[model samples]
Target: MLKARVITAIFLLIGFLAALFLLSPLGWTLLATVVAMLAAWEWGGLMRLVGIQRIAVALLLGVPCTTLMLAQPEALGLSGSLDKGAALSLAWWFLLPALGFWTLLVPLWLVRRFPLSGTAFGLLTGAVVLLPTWLALVLLRHLGPWALLGIMALVWIADIAAYFTGRAFGRRKLAPQISPGKTWEGAYGAVAGVLIYGLAVYFLSGSALALPLLLLIPTLLVLTAVSIIGDLFESLLKRQAGIKDSSQLLPGHGGILDRIDSLTSTLPLVTLLWLVL
Candidate 1:
């Protein structure tokens, strides 16, 4: 299992890096759309959709992505400038709501242990969870691949730090019902790790982020907490769905959704923040 996971991680990293640095803007958008589509399919599994139904759900989610790419190419940074166009409009119209969902509602849903129910609710929620993330992937990469990579690395650092810290010092549970493996100590470790990473990037990358330390530190802390919320939220869904993993598509890594779960939550907010400030 470990060997499969390592090999898979290596390949995924290589493919992701190639796409990130080498792909054209449209190519990157298409790749992100494909990822969103697959995640939507797994989301169908969580909602109890089967076979063709899952495929349909994937298509349903993917259509809007392709539509935005084709219909409003400028908005997606595919053709023209996104500085004062639909992309800015979308920052408010599309991603603001997504930001609200992640920062406001998801934490409540997590605490209440809300039951995932109703087809309409499920589908709408899936869109809320997905579309903005797809947009974030497109916009953030366009801003700069290394910028996007640095932000993503914050999440990776947090996750790694949390795992080791939890093993070493975990005592009290963070979310015992949703994910028993996580702990408050681990959460602290994640925050610390992210803070260190944020500071390093700020110093090393010079004007890359363009935020002062005061603002940057708070932002990093918030994102780290939200990343944990994202992970916990997915774990809750999988628990309620009575499944071990989202799907078995990624060999030992569970599924695409399993891998990008934190990204779904964090990316939209990062994009929104960049747009705002």
Candidate 2:
């Protein structure tokens, strides 16, 4: 299992890097759309929408992404027509609600253990979970592949730290019913890891995007918490749906959603910060 995971990680890293640096803006949008499509399919599986229902859900979410890209490439930083202000304004239409969903609704949903049922609600929830993420992927990459990479690395650093720290010193479960493995110790480790990573980037790059240590530390802490919520939310849904992984699409990695679950929650907020700050 470890070997399979390592190999898959290598290939995924290579492919992602190639796409990140090489793909045209439209190409990146298409690729992100494909990812969103597959994630939507897996999400449908979680919703117990089998066969045609799953495909329809995939199309329902995926097609509009492409349509929006084609109609308003400038809004995504794909082509230059609209100014940055206008483009950012358009992004808020999707991302503002996404911000609300992640920061407010998601925490409550997790605490209350709300049922993810009803076709209308399911679709709406999926849209809320997905579309901003798709937009974030495009906008962030456009902002600069390295910048996007650094933010993503923060999540990876946190997850890795949490995993090992949990194994070493975990005493209290973070969410025993939803995910048996996670613990509060792991959560603390995650925060510490991101703090170190944030500090390193701040002192090293000295970039304008690197908020001051005061602002940066708080933002990283909030993002770390938000990332955990995203992971747990998906875990809760899979448990409710009676599945282990979202899908077996990525060999040892499970699926795209499994890989990008944290990204789904973090990227939109990062993009919002990028625009506003």
Give lDDT tens digits, candidate 2, residues 1-277: 8898889999999999999999988888899999999999999998988999988999999777978887777788777533578568878888899999999999999889898899999999999999999988888886678888888998898899999999999999999988999999999999999988888888888852557777888899999999999999999999999989999889889988898888899989988888887
**Number of the top-ranking candidate, with TM-score as the measure:** 1
Mark the regions of model 2 whose C-alpha exceeds 4 Å error after superposition.
none
Stretches off by above 4 angstroms in model 1 are none
Q: Write candidate 1's Cα lDDT for 115-212 as tens digits.
A: 88999999999999999889999999877888889889988898999999999999999999999999999999999999888898788876435688
How much is 39 displaced in model 1, in angstroms? 0.4
Q: What do the candidate models score in CA lDDT, each in turn? A: 0.90, 0.88
